[model samples]
Target: MDEIVRSNCTDRMRSYLESGCSLHYQNISNLRHLHSCERELEDYINEANAVLKKLQRLVEDAYDATLTANLSAVKVPDYSTADSKMNHEYHFTEEKQEQPADELDRDSSLVTVMILVHNMLKLDYTMQEKIVRSLSLKSSSAEIESYRLMWDLRPYVDGSVMDLAWKSCP
Candidate 1:
């Protein structure tokens, strides 16, 4: 259970007991008052449940926003400027973007979730290599590593899909 729910339940329990405490000491009362107490308790429980759901939704929305912000902070490389013809030796010269201090503070768990989501359902390793081969790029260890990174980023591009067209190509 969520901490918010726990806290709300505790508060409601305290409030309910405080409000009904006098009933315990009162002389034999009609069943109507007992029913009223039960009804009030039910209402309090319902309200607490509603608040818990709202808090959960807010937390989920905040987590999604963080994932979006972190993913967007990564720079996709420009492939048009990259040398199409793979020479004997090649190195990516594209400069990576610098992230803001606050952006860099994103939780590692969120990053792991984003990476797993992107990698899920991706093409098999062999197919990925074939795709890389078609681009006239050699399969050196370093190049393959870079392509793997590109593959990881492929599924996460938001708007302007063409911006990632070349970067995600293999």
Candidate 2:
């Protein structure tokens, strides 16, 4: 992974830590705990959205750059004055386009996957937020336990994508 990508990933990790989005309160037995959980959820959702917006912009810029470069590389062979296209002789020389093009494609794909993973994380955060909001004093122990398990376990987060991101860590 490159420096920019590695540090962007670290930025995300820092965001998560700052927001405390990855925490779970298994036992919210009182009003104070409940309100704190609610506040934490709100903070988490806001922070997650901010991170997602930044990621989206980065992804969009990468994709747009790739598109612009690809468009410039594509050229139409002009044969307006030629009698027959097949009979016309053409000289083709591939001028060192492979390496840069391959790198652009890789970067584009990386940003795409990064956004996808971040969006997955955003959705997971939303789900946890909903669970937190639904909590009440009358809620059953089983339901609270289930919610805690879901929030802590994070079933919605794609492990493979996260693993790839972690591999980029410096």
Candidate 3:
């Protein structure tokens, strides 16, 4: 659940108890209360979106920094070597002995993985937004409850993947 939802949430259990069992949401104000809640929810989501965007920019900057640093250490292949023609055709360069290729490869791979994780988070948020927008008077109690659980649990976000992403972060 979002921090806003957790902190500023209304007394939902109390409200549910106050409403009589014979009533249907569609027959009443058509979830006007819930509509207001949705707006607040959207505001929280927007805040999160902004933060995610910022995080992505930071990751991109880090990747660019590492790339530039590594690029500076590369040396053009010696044209006089017999095998130079075969390797130079691909424009591959040799890394300075001081900077091991494995370390650079690890940095590049980390950047790629973080990017993939960031995209997954973006997609997850998009799905959550769609789910929030889908709520209506016609929604059954089961459906509404399902939506609540889905929003709270954020099933689209893989916990292990997120943990891995975090673990790899500098």
> What is candidate 2's lDDT per residue for 18-40, written digit by digit as tens?
66655333333455676887788
Per-residue alpha-carbon lDDT of model 1 for 71-155, expressed as tens digits?
8666553665434533422433222233353445644444444343333322333344454444322447777577667766754
Off by over 4 Å in 2: 1-29, 77-95, 168-170
Let me know the TM-score candidate 2 reaches against the reference structure: 0.63
- TM-score, prediction 3: 0.60
Instruction: List the candidate 3 regions with Cα displacement exceeding 4 Å.
Output: 1-32, 77-100
Among all candidates shown, the one with the greatest lDDT? 3
lDDT measured at residue 138 in model 3 versus the true structure, 0 to 100: 85
Report the Cα lDDT for residue 101, model 2: 73
Worst 10 residues of 1 by lDDT: 88-97
Cα-based lDDT for every prediction: 0.50, 0.73, 0.74
